[model samples]
Each structure stands twice: as C-alpha cells, then as structure tokens.
Target: MKTSIYATLAAVAFALPAMAQDMGDAANGEKEFRKCKACHMIQSPDGTDVVKGGKVGPNLYGIVGRKAGSQEGFKYSDALVKLGEAGEVWTTEDLAGYITDPNKYVEEKVGDPSLKTKMTFKMAKNQADVVAFLAQHSPDAGAASAGDAAEKPATN
Candidate 1:
C-alpha cells in the first residue's frame, strides 16, 4: 500500500509540469502575444489596458470562458455567430488552433467554408503560448474552466 501511494504521488508530481506545458506556459504566452497585438487587445472592463493594441478585433479580456462571437459592440462574422451557436466555449486547445488558422478552424467547427473572419493573419507558430496568455486575462475562467481547468480535479 505504501509503495502504491508513493508511486501515485510521484506520478502526480511529474505530471503537473507536463500538464502546465501542455496547456502552454502563460509567461511565454505573454511574450508571444505581441504577435497578436496588431489586431487584438486585452483590456479590462474598467478600461484598464492589459495589452494595448488596435481595435480591429474585439477586446479579448474574458474570451477564454466567453461565448464565441459574443463580445459586446463588435459585429461578428456569420461564421463566428454559427460557431457560438455550435456551443464553442473557448478552450486553449481550440483557441490555439484558431490563431493558427481562423478560417480553417471556423470552417471545421461551423462547417461553412464560405464564411470568413475579418482576421486575416494566420499565426505560423507559438499559438499555444499566445492562447495561454489570453487565458490568464480571462477572469471568468475559473477553477473549472480555461487553460488550467484540466488540472483542477487532478490536483484535488
């Protein structure tokens, strides 16, 4: 019994770092976000600038837990609306895929090739990092949600 318990504890200890890496490093993500700042900004609801950038994309303050296409005052593409309708609550994995290729991700999820996003740039790499950064800014992303959500029950 003692051996089994030790093994389990050891496994969990090693797993924690791997899990955090899989979810992407939030610190690295912050640096990677400079690539996204040209179009997107992460600002608090109180109007504090998290990462001040252009207004081309909607504010991404709470996007990780936010419903897709639902950022206030921003008109979403039909495909994004469809994505939200399809029940996409942003996860880091999904968001990483999205930053890599918005149109393709949308098409894959919403199944509409014709609908395109105003976001034209496709990030060639570091998508996980950028997503991790975004996740941190999402206040609504609690214990049961966002980048670290997978680790929640495991840690408990």
Candidate 2:
C-alpha cells in the first residue's frame, strides 16, 4: 500500500510541472517572433520580408506539416531535398530542433552527402520560448484546440 501511494504521488508530482508550462499566445509569439523577422517570414497568402523580400530561404507559412525543404519555388540543398523524399515530415519537435541548431539538425538528419544544407542561423538560446512562438504563430501549426493541447506528452 505504501509503495502504491508513493507511486501515485510521484506520478502526480511529475504531471504537475508538465501541466504548468504555458503554451504561449500567438499574438505574443507574433511580437516575440519579430526578432526572427530578419530571416523568416511566416505568411498565409504571401510572405513578406524587410530584408529585400527575396527568397533566400523557403517560405515558412505552412512549415509545420511540410516536408523539410519542400517549399514549392525555393531551392533547397540536396540534403534537405533528400530528407523530403525520404518521407520525413516536420513536427513541432523537429522545428524546435531546427530552431536550436539548424546546421546540426540538417547534418545529422539528412542522408545526402553531396548536398549540404547551410542554414547556420541560431535562434535565441531560450529555445522553449522560440518553440512556443513557433507553435503559436504559424498558421499551419495545425489542429489547434488550445495551447499545446495537441502536444505530445513529455517523455522521460
């Protein structure tokens, strides 16, 4: 009985912290994501850029479910294209990893050797904030019920 009680308490304790994380507000994320405006444009009908509005990188409007490097008109490195062809789809976790270290994630995930993705951009060190912003702001983040309502449960 003691062991069971302790286990129940442990489980509740673990769940409490997870329940406490704020999923963030998109409106707030839009403001916070302003810092990223230099590099990324998350648009719905069309994307805009302050820095020449040119297509240096792919449009990220629907990036949440999009395959890596699969934007229609943009040119992607062979590595990213290969990742797309391999049936890899972008999820929030993948986006978070990319936000943390684009080059590293591409290097580790892309199987193509000849083509290297060169996104060396680093998000602010506080990736949780970035992730929250991404999740909240992206139009294609998909199936939103509530903040992080669809989020996968935290794993040990």
- For model 2, what is the error of residue 75's alpha carbon versus the real structure, in angstroms, after optimal superposition? 1.1
Worst 10 residues of 1 by lDDT: 147-156
Q: CA lDDT of each candidate? A: 0.79, 0.59
lDDT of 1 by residue, 19-57 (tens): 777767777878888877888899999999999998888
For model 2, residues 33-138, the per-residue Cα lDDT tens digits are 5556665666555435322322456656656656777777777777777777777677666776777766667767764345556565777555555555555435
Could you tell me how far off, in angstroms, the CA of residue 78 lies in candidate 2 after the best superposition? 1.3
User: Where is model 2 more than 4 Å wrong at Cα?
Assistant: 1-32, 46-54, 111-115, 137-156
Lowest summed-lDDT stretch of 10 residues in model 2?
A: 147-156
Q: What is the Cα-based TM-score of model 2? A: 0.63
Query: How high is each candidate's TM-score?
Result: 0.83, 0.63
Q: Note the residue pairs that clash in candidate 2.
A: none
